[model samples]
Target: MFKKLDFFLFGWIINWMYPEYYRPKYGYQRYYILFFHYLIPQKLFRLNPKVRWPVHFTSKVLAAENIKKGILCDPGDNNNNYIQANNGIIFGSNIELGPGVSIISSNHKGNNLREHTKGKPITIGNNVWIGANSTVLPEVSIGNNVIIGANSLVSKNIPSNSVAVGNPCRVIKPKEDYSEDLSVIIFNKKIVEKFDVFLNSNV
Candidate 1:
């Protein structure tokens, strides 16, 4: 009806307004929300001042201004993800947050229902992957090259090169081949090589 026509018009407008969205193969870049049922509403959320990076339409990032995230990351890619960084949060590059993951940086005070307790910022290092349905509590520091398994609850600090899982999220194994500099270089090289391949398939 009118809604379909409205989106059609908006899509055309977007194509015209933002030439930077154009690609050689795809023509004009269109995000998942554009074709999906959730359209303009999610677009508005992405433009909000509280949003630090692209978030899934169903995800919510409260107090995102308090978070310092490096490189590109979509916190809630699949859905139902929430990042509450009221206290503050620092994230290094190449961080992946699976669906239903929650990173909470503040907690409600016991004495006062409305008031929140001050906590240290959650500091996450590079190349960390927090699995689906995982919950990272306030003031937890996870070092580089860490993988928090699915449905895990991170309550304390997790050191580098660790693979952890459980209700209390403990490290079960240490990664043998993990280098911070190599990780960053590999990611960057992959991105660069991908674009090069797109431009020159023979190359």
Candidate 2:
């Protein structure tokens, strides 16, 4: 039929255009493959063929929303694992998540067997490096430029520019003060003098 042909053509076009984004080397490519193979076929048979492609495309867009908002940090470098992130998570830029890192943003109350749902947002700061197999609990905000050791359980907020380690993750030391603009400290008198106007304005 004409409808079946149209769905096949559209799915093929999507695969060609976004080969890397949908089929990254690190992950299993399960979602991308499923959308085209199983989901599309079922929809075409039962529902309108034209609707199948659009619905699959919308799911991809939702996944991207999670990444851009910093709720789920996937730098295209971490190993693939079954990771789930809900809405309201905020992540900073340049965050590196190692393999098997799980961030849980929702939890239930202890006394209620009926699962009292609580909405907690997880925020990861910029330039953060989370080690492999680490679990970040709900309602936690990790400050910028932090380094978390491997296999650690983060249950609390970590201050900026510190190294945190252990099961319940504790800050080992306070981060040293450094210039954010210039990587190296501006100790040179001439450089400071050259930018005196800019520094004065900032102060």
Candidate 2's error at 30, in angstroms?
Answer: 19
Query: What digit string (tens of lDDT, one per residue) describes model 1 on residues 59-85?
Result: 777887787765434454447888888
Q: What is each predicted model's overall lDDT from 0 to 1?
A: 0.66, 0.54
Cα lDDT tens digits for candidate 2, 103-170: 76656567876663566667888668888888888778999879999999999999998999899999
The estimated TM-scores of all candidates read 0.69, 0.52
After superposition, the stretches of candidate 2 with alpha carbons farther than 4 Å from their true spots are 1-77, 109-116, 176-203
Show the colliding residue pairs in model 1. Answer: none
